[model samples]
Target: MLDQSLLSQSRAGLSEIEAEYIASSLLRVCPPVSPQHTNLEVTKLLNEHPELISIAVVEDNKPMGLITRNVFMEGMAKPYHHDLFDRKSCIAFMDKEPLVVDQNMSIQTLSFKVLGSGRKTLNDGFIITDENGDYLGLGNGEDLVRVVSFLQAEKNRLVTESINYASVIQKSFLRSSRESMAAVLQDYFMHWEPRDKVGGDYYFCKKFDDGFFLALIDCTGHGVPGAFMTLIMASFLDHILLEDNRHDPAGALAIMNKKVKTALGQINDSAAEGFDADRFSTKQNGQSDDGMDTAFCWVNTQNSTLTYAGAKTALFYIGDASSDVQLLDPDRKGVGYVDTPMDYQWTNQQLALSKGMCIYLTTDGLIDQIGGLKKIAFGKKRFSGLLQEHYLKPMPEQESIIMQTYYDYQGKQKRRDDVCLMGFRF
Candidate 1:
């Protein structure tokens, strides 16, 4: 049975030309009969082939008209009607102007034509013809709809499968847990949530020789494209810190800028001596601006100190209630762009912390979220207040409280982006 509900659903607003079904699929292979064929012969053919809804009436190998089951049956129901017409040609009862459709016509347009062609054609069916006006076969209205419905279902199923697979890959790239940092971090909290099943925002943590290398990264965009950038960024960070033995956060960023530009073939746009103005001008400007913003931190437990550097990312620190909150700014440049000078330097800040000081690393996704009664941004000011209000709470409890407060403020507003908030106490 046809699902009446599906008939009303739009076909993704695709134009008739874009729909997959054309005249070929809807066309049936029933043979055409000569116009001279008698009514008795036509009745025998339709009786033997119950599925044949219509057959073409042709003369001299050219389509003359269509004889549908209804016209044949109704004509035969009348008393002595067959006796008079039994010797007559089938063309006498055929629809002389049955609707004929071109082979290239979309199913959507075909269905529309069928519905508006008057009630007589409701069961008369349509004729399918090639571009050259040659008779192909007959098309039943019911069959064309079924083909379109199947196409829509298959497209939806494939898209769902692709998204689920991408979600698995995105999760594999995330750090297992902030709890793993307990040995050196003493107390810590982390909240990472992607607005979509797979998102571009992610955090990385790896225990190094003296302490730990931790970073909160936000790639160029969100969803699959952004997620892909995370994978690339992760690979580059791993190589820079582990294989190259580079540990300074600022130096690592410098290498990151160079490598990312090179990987994307944006080296000609760099500020280095090799930069080519003609080559840069010939290409579209800002075409290779894809990159990441990151807060990179190295906690050196060996010296009981913390070092930090940022690439378009920020750090918030609090020593105690007596101390004012400190905001450390990152270099005003992204990691993989040609806009900044090639010799652009990333700076590092070393902080001698109190035994219980708290430090935070976050992406703009958290602060830039749009929510609240006024529908304004949950800006830096509110974030600062949130951390300060709950800094005294235990790390785990603080995490829960902060998340709950965030949700309350968000209310019914859709999440604007992927959010990642990290806190560690010395």
Candidate 2:
């Protein structure tokens, strides 16, 4: 007789099964026969249930082997086969070494096991057992394949929706302070793109009593992790600007460095004592070495001056008096790492702002992108030439030209990192 209690229990748990254990839903309540049953009796039972594909042979509720419909019918159709084995035990035709799986196994793990086990399991099906190795029911390979494909498609749809929502949130945050930038700048243009739906590269602008403060930051990693770091950096930067260092670009950077280190727990003295610069890693030190490279500027329009500071980043500007683009190198050290000293000081480089002066700030993403006929990095030299060639153009036009050049050189190659470039004219 069929185990009606087990069938009812499997049906009850259908709604509660998690995505990981979806394979358990494939259980079919096929009645089992004992090994002592005659072949003629087993054939009578199979003929009565035309829909049955296979049945389990059990002794004391534990599965002993499997008897598939095709194998049984093929043997019975042979000449004198039924007459010879009519009174023989069902064990004569049963596959003693059939694949048996626990009902609670995850779908992914079951798929791997099925693939590794031979192709016969697919044709003959398999037996499902409980945690105690007792017979539960049977499972169909065809049903398993269909369920796996459906689950995979559903997972991809959900993930894509989530990432699309995240991209919207990140964009909203980046634009929150954009009015401040528009109020002070004579002209400006910004280009930001992530290799994925969301990225780590971000820019910030805030209007101060003097002029404005602007920053272009490249945080550690890319995609979701990088996006998370941008939010953290933005929060800390806002707090520092509002409460502590409003007018000093270098002072702001120094404070931000400490804040990042403290937030990530990268300020341990014990970890720093034996630090080997060449072999240092987050795994070895038991701390996240995540940090950001930033180019920060405080433009004092009233004084016609700009104070610029950087952490492993640089600034480029073409003064009205000369056609050449000049570079302002940053401090050699990066911010917010296990190796960076807590009290490290970064100095500011001040330059006079003149009419028609054009300034540019960028993350390493653009320069480090690999492409072109030779498949080399875009490099600093090519970037400088591109800036010098188009510095005289209008800000919007300059942005278009720069982006076009980048894409043209990037032909057939994949983007390596997030890219952000900002240009402004005084």
For every model shown, the clashing-pair count is 0, 0
TM-score of 2: 0.60
Candidate 1: residue 287 lDDT (0-100): 34
Task: Give candidates' CA RMSD values in order.
Answer: 23.7, 24.8
Q: Whole-model lDDT for model 1 versus the true structure?
A: 0.70
lDDT of candidate 2 vs native?
0.76
Error of 1 at 401 (Å): 1.8
Candidate 2 per-residue lDDT over residues 314-400, each given as its tens digit: 999999878798999999878887678889999899999999999999999999999998999998889989889988889989999
| Cα-based lDDT at residue 17, candidate 1 | 36
lDDT of each: 0.70, 0.76
How far does residue 380 in candidate 2 sit from its true spot (Å)? 1.5
Model 2 ranges with Cα > 4 A deviation: 1-161, 269-284
Q: lDDT tens string, model 1, 248-321?
A: 88888888787666544455544323333232221355235667899888878788777889988999999854
Please give the TM-score that candidate 1 achieves against the real structure. 0.58
